[model samples]
Target: MGESGTGEARPPSQMIDERIRELGDWRGDVLSQIRALIRQADPAVIEEWKWRGVPVWSRGGIICTGETYKSIVKMTFARGAALQDPSGLFNASLDGNTRRAIDIHEGEAIHPEALKALIRAAVDLNMSRTRR
Candidate 1:
């Protein structure tokens, strides 16, 4: 839980909603779309706010984090290096051994099916790790 502007403790989901509304621009729209896509991909995914208000989606473990900057919306996939991204959605953080990311700028379009496949793969990888 994080404190709101009024200093009240709030759940992560509520905090996420506020963060989206607070953006009030293309970044907000992008974040909102990403959130919906993540939910559609994994209905059991959990929403979390971490490291000072970043939105994280997880199932067995973290699927991705939705982070916003002034010029781009970044979705950093945890354990992304382990997932097979056949559609080539990962354009950022490719240098890392254990993580990958997709950076979306204004007017950029995300391939929904491809992103969903990537997310499902992440979930599968997480579950496999959990069972091990």
Candidate 2:
């Protein structure tokens, strides 16, 4: 179960929906867009609410996490360091050994196709690993 800010326990999918509603701002819009792209890229992707309030997207393993903060919405990829980001969508956590993140601020425009490509690549990476 995922806990809301109010400390109420609920299903992760339901909690994620409420979190999007609760944001009620540009962050919500960005997160929503990201979610849509992820779903478009991989229809089989699973959404899980983890680390208390974060929105996590996974396939064979974690693909990325959506973390909304005061100034930005961060999408952190679990094996981002190993992925080839030709579009350079990842702008945060670049120095990390295992993860990479894309930080979107207010009014920032996301490249739909580029993000979808990234999401697909992440899913492929997870699937390949699981097959081993």
Candidate 3:
């Protein structure tokens, strides 16, 4: 499809660019950081705006998602419950069964190495799932 304003054709999955452009100010920083992390971790991974308010990356299956709220940026892994999170970054919510999240507060620092490890693990996990 073509971009609404630019009229330049884009891949189907990237059609969500418009939604990303519409994200409010509160979410911009978080989204930028998430995109940077994804690019640093794997330059080849495909990024798509999904779930209305999240940045989603995928290879064989969904890798992870980043969402923003008033005070925090949350990164979630689709199969997070299965990942070996030695850093204890995974936050197990009371209502979920296969997802895990890491919340980053304003002014807080995110460990790039740790984030990259998690990203790599997520990609590997998705690849393994597709192989089965």
CA lDDT of 68 in candidate 2?
Answer: 99
- Per-residue lDDT tens digits for candidate 1, residues 24-58, read 99999999999999899889999999999899999
Q: What is the TM-score of each candidate against the true structure?
A: 0.94, 0.93, 0.77
Q: In model 3, state the lDDT of residue 102.
A: 84
Tens digits of per-residue lDDT, candidate 3, 8-114, equal 75663454444346665545556666678877988878876655435678877888887667787778788888788877777545257788888877777777788
Full-model lDDT for every candidate: 0.93, 0.93, 0.72
Error of 2 at 17 (Å): 0.8
Q: Please give the clash total of every predicted structure, in order.
A: 0, 0, 0
Residue pairs that clash (backbone atoms under 3 angstroms), model 2: none
Give, for candidate 1, the lowest lDDT window spanning 10 residues.
1-10
What's the residue-level lDDT of 41 in candidate 3? 87
lDDT of 3 at 81: 81
